[model samples]
Structure formats: C-alpha cells, structure tokens
Target chain A: MTPDKLKTILLVEDDDKLGRQVRSHLTEAGFEVDWLRHGHDALAADPSQYGLIVLDLMLPGTGGMDVLKHYRGQRCDVPVLVLSAKTDAAIKVRALDLGADDYMTKPFWPGELVARVNARLRRPLANAGDSIEIGRLRLDQSARRLFVGEESVDLTRVEFDLLLALARRPGVAVERGWLAEHVLDPERDGTGRTLDVHVSRLRRKLGDRAVCLQTVWGVGYRLEPDA
Target chain B: MRLRPRLALTALLAGIPLIAGSVWARSAIERSNAVDGLTRLVLQRMLDGGRDECSRWPESWPIPSGPGMGPGMGPGMGPGMGGEGMPTWEERQTRMQAMLRGGGGPRAFSHLGPPVEFFAYSADLTSRNRLAPALHEDLRTGLLDGRKVVSRGRSNDSDSPLEIAVRMDWFDEPESPSAIVLARQVGASEFGLAREFLWGVTALVSVMLLTLLLSAGPVVGRARRLTRNVRRSATDQYATSIPVEGSDEISELALAFNAAGAQCRAHTDLLEQRERSLREFVEGTTHDVMLPLTVLQGHLTSLAKTSSGEQAATLRDAIEEAHYMTSLIQNLATTAKLEAEDAPPRRDPVDLVALCERVVARHMPVGREKGVRVEPVLPGDPVVVRGDETLLEQAVSNLVHNAVRYVDRDGRVLVVLSAESGRFSLRVLDDGPGISPDQIGHLTERRWRADDVRARHPSGSGLGLAIAKEVALRHTMELTLGTAPELGGLEADLQGALG
Candidate 1:
C-alpha cells in the first residue's frame, strides 16, 4: 500500500495554533486525524480508534506523562508519538519508557510530522510473523537474508541489524536510543551517531530504496514504506 | 628657674634694698642726735663750774690782773689762792680731767668723756704772744669783752689735735682773765655706732624683703603658668587637651574637651554605618527583581507569536502593559537605590559598541514594522569601559525603544558609540518631537512623564529616561537628555568608562 493510504492518527497538543496546524497537515497526508487539546482529552479518547497518537508533554488539565501512564495502565497497544517544546534528554527517555513509540520537539517541519505518524501506524508489522515485505524489498527472519525481487543483497553486521530493525516494523519509527540498545552492541564502538553512519551506509547499499529512512528533526529516525 | 620663681625673686630684690636704706637712715639720725645733745650738756656744766670757782673768791683777795684787772689789794688775790689750802689752776685742771675721764660728771654726759687736751691762756699781751696767733687773738677778744668763748679750733702744728676751747672771764676780779680749754681726741666710736646701726637696719630690711619675695614667688609663678597653659590649649588645634594633673579648674576643662571629641566621633561613626546598610539593601532588592522581569518578557514574546486576529491583538496589548509596568517598577527601584547613601556601584568592563548593538537589535524589528529606520553607528574596535553592564544595556535599550515608539514613519533613530580620553560614550538620537526645555528637568525623576510628548505616543511607561539617568549616576557617569542638533529630536548621551 502507498504511505498516503495510512489511516487513523491521534494529535495531542495544549497550544491551540500548533495543534490545529498539525491536524490539518496530517489530514492532508490522507490520514484520519483525531485532535485533542490536552493530555486529559487524549486519554479520554478511544485509544483503539487511532493507529497512532502525537502527544505533547506540556498540556493543561493533565500533563503528557500522566496521559502516557493512563494509556499504559489500560494496556492500550496503540502506538504513541510524544510531542513537546521541552528539548531535554531526560524528558524524552521518560516518555519512551512510558510506552510512547517516539518523541518530537516543537517547530518541527510538517513533512516530518506526517512521516512520523505513518511510521507509528506501521509498527504492527514488527510483531506480525517475522517475515515482512515492502515493494521489491523482502526480509526472511528464518533465512537471515534480505532480497530485492529475487536478487540477494549483501550488508555488514551493523547494516544488517539496522535493516532488520526497520524491516521488522515495516513503516514504524524507532527512536535513536532504541536502535542503539537493540541493534548496536554496547561493547562495540557503536553509538547514536554510529547508528546514523550505519543507516547512511545501509541506505547507500540499498540505493533507490533509501527513501524508506526519514529524519524527523528533534525526533528520531523513521522507516516509511514506499507509496 | 620657672617664671613663678623668677618673679618672686625680682620682687624680693627690689623691695629689700629700699627697706634696708630706710632703716639705716633712721638709725643714723637718732645716733647723731643723741651724741650732739650729750656733748652740749657736758660742756655747759664744765663752764658753769669754772665760773663758780672764780666767783667764790673774796673781794680782799689779790687777783692776778693782766688785761681786764688793775692793781687791787684784796684777801682773794691770785697768789693767796695758789697756796696749799685751795686747789691751784693746774690742780683744778687735773681734777676736771679726772672727772671727765671717769664719765661721772653728770647724767647728761652719759657716754661722753673728758677732753683729750686742756689749755689756759692769759689776757695779757705777753702771755697771749707765747700762744698761737689764732689762740692769742681769740683770748684777747674774749678778755676785752669779758665773755666766755667756746670754739672748735685746730692747732697750727700737725702734731696737735682738734680741740674745743671754753674761754671764760673771772667775775670776782674784772682785770683778772682766764680761759679753760677742754679737748679730746676725735674718736670714730660714736660715728661707728651710728654706722653700725644703719648697717644693721639695712641688713634687717634686706632680710624682710627677701622673705617677702621668697614667700610670694611660687604663688605668682604657678598662677602665670596656669594662665599660659590655658591660653596655649585654647589656641592649639590638635592638642586641644590640657594636662589634667591636678584637681583644679584647668583639669576639669581638659576632661570636658575629651568628652566632646568622643561624642563627635561616635556620632560620625553611627551616621556612616547607617548609610552603608541602606546602600546594601537597595542593591540587593534591585538584583532580585530584575530576574523575574526578564523571564516574564520572554514568556510574553512567545505568547504574542501564537495568537491570531483579536486574540493576538489582546495578547500584544497585555504584553505591552506588562512591559510598561515592569519598566515603571524598575525605574522606581533604581531611583530609590540612587537616593540611598554610599550605594555600591556595579562596575565591570563592558563593550559599549556591542552593548549599543544589542539594544538596537532589540528595538530594530519594531522600528522596521513602524517604517522607522534604526541606524547603529558602532565603533570598529570594541569600546570597552568599566560600569554596570545590565544597567547600561537597559539604559541604551530604553533610549532605542523610545526612539522607535515616538518617531514618525520613515524617521531615523541613530545610536552612536565612540570613545576618547579613556572614556566610552553612547548617544541615542531620534528624529521625533524633541523634549521641551521644561520637560527635560522632570524626565529623570521617578514617575515624571511629559504629558505633551506622551500624548503623541502613550505606549511608553515614561520611566525609560529616568532609569537611564539613575543607572548612569550610580556608575559615576553622566547621562544628558536633550534635543539632537542635527536630528531635531530627543537625544540621550550616556558617557562612561575609558576606551
């Protein structure tokens, strides 16, 4: 399916102007956008109806962390994208720990916002079967091989781990820390910047398929399936 | 010796001589008078005895006559009396000498003695010729008158002594004449007594004068010394204390002076302490208040950007109101701080050009929106100076903001920075309605707004220039508010620090 064919998104923002702008842009990207003014409103909305949620940390009535706590308390499995003007690292880690799928700071480009939303909607593919397919690209967990339309592609250890993490999720976004913890070994010389170098290296190897990796400024990277 | 002793000695020296002279003169006069009286009485008695002896003779006696007596046949003749039954003239002379020598003749002759020599002279020319011519003439003259003659006479011979002669005529026989002369060696014993008396009086007077001087010397000297010390202490500026060694009025004066000095010092110290505390309080309050204000300004700027239409307009109005209120509070705080004594000035090296540029940047957006141009004339080199950076920045910002707010569309606001003589100066000039002469005086004062100028642009808090002036003063710098000569608008020149 095309990336624009994704449906259902949740936007949580306290600021009236920014929230409205974000909703309009996400709706224009062919996604059903449900907008809420604060953390309390987002928590009250039916979590199952939305595939993804854009949550702001600073919200009147109830703070974003409390909303995240409530969503996790209800065992809601919907993907959550945390949004805020707070750029501190501690705040991002806390949100991600509370089951938020990703985080973004304010003044972010609208295109990046749409991309992040699409990536969150695609997160279910990682748990579906262990084999995932996107256009000519295919990954087989059992074989440990990645093929582009019957032609096998070669990748380094770091590049293979990076591609698997993204290929498993299909269209979901993965934060920088998540990639560093799961794909990159702590004993090795790899870091967050190392992950980016590997991503760029992998994209170079994938060639025309590099459009799948997107940078969501102030947020982390996301993988988007081609339209 | 000291002045007191010297004065006493001088008094004694002058008085002792005068008293001694008076005593000596008095004693000498008394001794001479007593001696003179005794000599006169003794001589009279002697003469009277001689006359009595001559008168006792009977008329029948034959008396030797030379010049006064003629031939006479009488029982009392001169040769008859010369026999052993009566004392002869020589024998009488000897007895009289004995009487005078014994000092037993009379009470009137007390201390007087007999003459040292005696002589008799006859009235006959032949007897008188044998004597000295002066004696002979004196004897002849006395016999011719038949009168007793007493005269002090000196002999022609040097060997002979001074003599007193008593010549008397015999009354029994007129022709018979005789003179008795009694003389004594002139002894200095009587005059010596008078001289001794005078010397004794002089000695006594000198002793008394010395005693008087010695007794009065210390008292006078002490008094004079006290006067001098008091005068010297009064005129002395540094050593205003008189030594209080004794329980006297001078000691009391010293104590009073010391007490006065201590009181003055205490008062001065108290005033200084109070002034210092007041300054500290003002400085601390100003620092605390500025932090909150800056935060508030940042929040407002963010708020203004998010709202739209009337909401945006309302937010802008709120922000402006807040800015005005904050400015007023800042100005009031600064003014109060300045009025405090010994306020600690916030001094640091600051770049004037950079400071002015920052202020211009803060106001430039607004200026551009209003179609007013903000021209910053920054120096090529960093114009560094020592002053309070925050206050300087605020002052420059105030001037720039005011320019942008008041000037007409297309009007220019010029911020010029320059340095000379180790002093950095910043001037903000605008082509707007210049401040009137009357308003300039009140512009720097707290809450004093020019109504005429403010009416044209009521957005300002009217405390910008006041705060600027106060900040300038605190840094020991100058802030002059006037009309720019070239721009024909308000000009604020704040000069501080050295280049």
Candidate 2:
C-alpha cells in the first residue's frame, strides 16, 4: 500500500490548544487524526487500529507512561512518538525504553511534528531497492557506487558511505554527529569535521549536480531533487 | 601538645611543690631531732665529769687577779702545774678558759672526742674563766631562767654549729644554778648533707612520678579514645557520634561533640529536603512554562508559514523570542539543579559523541532559521564519559546554542568532540565575530553579556556559558574559553578524562 493512504494517527494530549493544532497539522499532512484528551482513553483504545500514536507524557488520568507501558505490554507494534514538556534525558530514555519509537521535546514546530509523524509512518527505506536516487545524484547500495546523471562519480569509502547515508533520507536533515559515527570508518578520526571533509569531497565529485546535495547547517547533509 | 603528653606535663608540674614541701618538712624534723640528741649527749658527757670536778669551783668564787698570765706563764705553768704547788686560781681559770675555747690548753676530759670542750659560767651568768668562749645573750638569759636553750650558730660554711646551754647546780645549791655549761657541735655531722639531699630528692621524684603515672593513665586513655572517636565520626561523614562515658571533662567534651554532630546531621537533612523541594519546583515551573510556550510556538510557526514579507519576518522574530525563552527556562532549571552543592552528579557513562549529536540536532532548526551553520565534529565510536547525562547534555546544548546565538548569519558553528592521547576534549567553535580575549573571561560569568551583543540581542541573559562552566566544574572537568584556532571565533573547550 502507498505510505500516505488513509492511515489513522492517534494523538493523546492534555493541552487543548496544543492537541488541536497538532491534530490539524496531521490532518493537513494527509493522515486521519483520532485525538484523545486523556491517557486512559488512549490506553483503552486498541493500539492496532492506528498506523501511529502521538503520545504526550503529561496527561490527565492514566498518564502517558502507563499507556505506553500498556500498549507495549500488549506487544502492539505501532510506532509511538512521545511528546513531552519534560526535556529531561532520563524521561526521554524511559519512554524510549518503553518502546517509544521517537521523542520530541515540547515547544516544537507544527511542521517538524508533521514531518516526524510522516517519517515514522513511511516504510523502511531499506526495502525499496539496492539503489536510491535524488535528482541527478543516484546511489547503488550493493555496488557501493554513486552516479550523477549520465556520468559516474568517483568516491572514497568514507565519501560513498556519507552520501549513501544522506541519500537514504532525502530532504530530511540528519544529525552530523550520527553521520560521523555511522558513515565514517571507525578506525579513522570520524569527527564531525572529518565527516564535513568527506561530504565536501563528495559534493566536489558531484560536479554541477552538487546543488542537489544540500548542507542542513546545524544538522547534517540532505540529498534533494534538483528541479 | 597532644593529650597524653599534656596530661603528663601537667602531672609533673603539679607534683613539684608537693614533693619539695615533703622533702623540706622531713629534713626539718630530722635536723631538730639531731640537734636534740647531740645536746643530750654533750650534756651527759659534761655531767659525767663527776662530783669532784664539779665541786672544785666554789659557790660564789671571787674574781682572781693575775699579775702575770701571759704566754710566757702559759708554757712554764702548764695545765699540769709540772710538780709545782697547785696553780693559783688566776692561772687555773685562764688555762681552763683557753682549753674551753679550743686554744689547746690541757684536756680536762680525755674520754671525750677532740672537738668537745667546756667551761663553767657563774650563777650570775658570768664566766669565771677569762678566756671562755663568748655566749649569746639569748642563751645566757635562757640558762639563767633554768631553761635549756638550743640555737643554730651562724657560720661562713655549710656546716653550721648547733649550740646549747644548760643550767648546772653544784655544792648543795638546790634552788638555783651555780654555773652554766655551754656546748656546741663543732664538726659536720657523720653524713654529708649533699648526699642526703640527693637521696631525698631522688626518692621524692620517683614517688611523685609513679603516683602521677598511675593517676593520669586512665584520664589520658579516655582522652585518647575520645580523640579517636571524634576522628572516626568525621570520617563516617558525621553519621555517628562519640559515646559519652563517665562524668569527667573528657565526657563533657564528648557530650558537646555529640550534640554538635547531631546538629550537623539535622542541618544536612534539612538541606537535602530543601534541595529536593527546590528541584521539584524548578521542574514543575519548567513544565508549566513549556506548555504555554509550546502552544505559542505552534501558533507562531503556523503564522510565519502562512504570512509573507514583513509579517513573516516579524513572526520569525517572535518564534525566536519564544525559543530564547525556552532556552532561558532550561538554563534556569539547570541552575536550580546545580544548587544542591553536596550532591554529586549521576555517574552514568555518557557518550560524548551522541551528546554532541543531540546538541547539534536540538539547535539545528534555530540555526537554519538564523542562517548559521551549527555542526558537530565527533569520533566514529562512542566517546563515553562518566557523568549525569541530563547535565552533560544541557552543558553541551548551552555551548552549541551560545555559539549559534552570537555568531552572525551564514556563519558556521562546530561542536567538536576529540579523544586523543587518552583525553576527551569537547570544543564548541564558531566562525563569526568572536569575543575579545578580555571578554572571553567574562563570558562565563553569570548574566554577563558582551557589550556588542546587548544592542542586537537585548534579551540574551548570558547564562548559557555560565551554566556550561558550572556543569564542567561539577564533573571535575575544566571549561576554558578562547579564540577558536581554526574557525577564529569564540571557542569553548571542555577538557575531561576519558572514561
């Protein structure tokens, strides 16, 4: 099935304004919104009916943790994105440990929230194929090579891994720190600056098509389709 | 200066006078008994001369006048008279006086020791012998009143004479003394007083020291025990108190210490309670504040997305103000948590690599909006350090956020975590107009902003660097500020040991 096709999103939040805005945003993002104001209602509802659950930690009655625990206890595999005003790392870790798929601190942008919801509902990109293409920049995963339009681009192992990591999630900002640890060779100094070097070299090799490989500034790199 | 030595010294000091007084009193008594016995012995010897010698002198003899009693007559008219007729009264008297004065006349009593000599004084207290030794007036008066008198005679040597005078009645005179016998000890005693004094002092000191040791042993022991217990309690974090024993001063000290220890424990408990409540309040305030702020942010985001031109820009500024408020609240909460000074940060192994990532991620949107490029330079593997994760995250977040806030638009900010030479170094570097070297030192001062930023960023509380510095200090790490070597902007470096 197509990822955005008539999926239902369950939103459990206490604050009226915040919950309404989030529901409206999710609706605009082409998802059916089933909003609940209390944690008990969320717990009572069947988690399997929804494609995703947006849980707020501070809820009236049952509490978000309890609901999360209940859902997880039932072995429901739906993705849960925890929204909390408590920015403490321990709580975030706790929610994650309770099978939360994602965590977003409060005072977040509606746009960002919508993006997270969609990203969670999207199919795992690994199943798509061995290759990922964004505009003229294409990556062949099995062959470990990249191509820009009709010409093949030469890439070092580090540069290839960096581009492949970004190309897997086109238009989405990945953290530079994550790219450094995962894409760069562990034996080498895979620091953010080191990752930056690899990205720069990869962009240079992309030549005129380098415009499609975008830097997300405070975030990491993003592969965009060139119009 | 410690308890044992102090007690011993005090014992010695107190023992001195008692020992000296005992020795002095014993010596005085022995001296008096010696003088009395010597007087009796001398008097008995004089009396042992018998009735013939005692009756030789008439009851009230007239004074004898001598025409030639010089040295010439002394040799010719020897004490024996040399077979001549009995010596005249004048010659006999002179010879007797010379002998009594130890002038080497005749030995009237050969049985007595050589130092012994005596002569007679008439009833009127006048010596019949012209050369008799001069008597003290007190002794003479004491003799005339029928009282035996003993006195210590002043002399230039340590061996002073013990002199005595007694009444003698002779020739049927029963009511009054017809003569007085004056005698004195002429030689030192049989034992040297120096040796006696040495023995006395040695004995006294030995007894005193032994007594002091026995008496002060338990006191010192108790004092030592108290000292040890006090130290142990301190090492035990004042969780335990010294036991009180006995009714002595040491016990009093123990009681005082126990009270003080109890007070300290109570204060610690009160402080812990206060800290817990304060942390709760800060957390609650953070939650309450964030709820509204989040709603505000959502509305602003919606507005800015739909608006255009000036309206969009203003909405963007409003969103940034909300973000600044969020960060300020976070810093305030962190500051509140840090106020519990005695509580050590949680010792979980924190990954600096992930930490830098989260910090960069958290600030990414704001950085993108400001056109500032905030990035992380981390190691490939996790660089783990032991600390409280939340505090560490906040510290790093502050560093990155501060760099993003002050750095100009289109500038680059880097959060670099480097592990080299077995050391973990975290640095936040930016490529914008950096603080002057002078201002760098003040950057970490709470609420102190660079003079240049106040005009453009008037709302900046300047608490970011300060909070980061505090977190680093709590973790036993060093937070240093300087110009970035590569980026040429402000570089905040946190150096710590690799976990």
DockQ winner: 2
* CAPRI rating of model 2: acceptable
Candidate 2 wrongly placed segments (more than 4 Å): A5-10, A26-52, A70-79, A111-129, A149-162, A165-207, A213-227, B1-39, B50-209, B227-242, B247-275, B349-358, B368-386, B416-426, B444-461, B495-499
RMSD of every prediction: 23.3, 8.4
| Model 1 lDDT tens row, B204-292 | 76676677767777556556665676567546532455455576665565567566655655676788678667656754555445444
lDDT of 2 by residue, A10-56 (tens): 89998899989988877877888999999779978998878889999
Count residue pairs with overlapping backbones in model 2: 3
Best TM-score among the predictions, by candidate number: 2
Weakest 10 consecutive residues of candidate 1 chain A by summed lDDT: A214-223
lDDT for residue A107 in candidate 1, whole number 0-100: 31
Write down the DockQ of candidate 1. Answer: 0.01
Q: Give the per-residue lDDT of model 2 (tens digit) for B161-237.
A: 65666665451264233256656656544225534865777677777777777787888788889989999998876
Model 1 lDDT, residue B90, Cα: 57
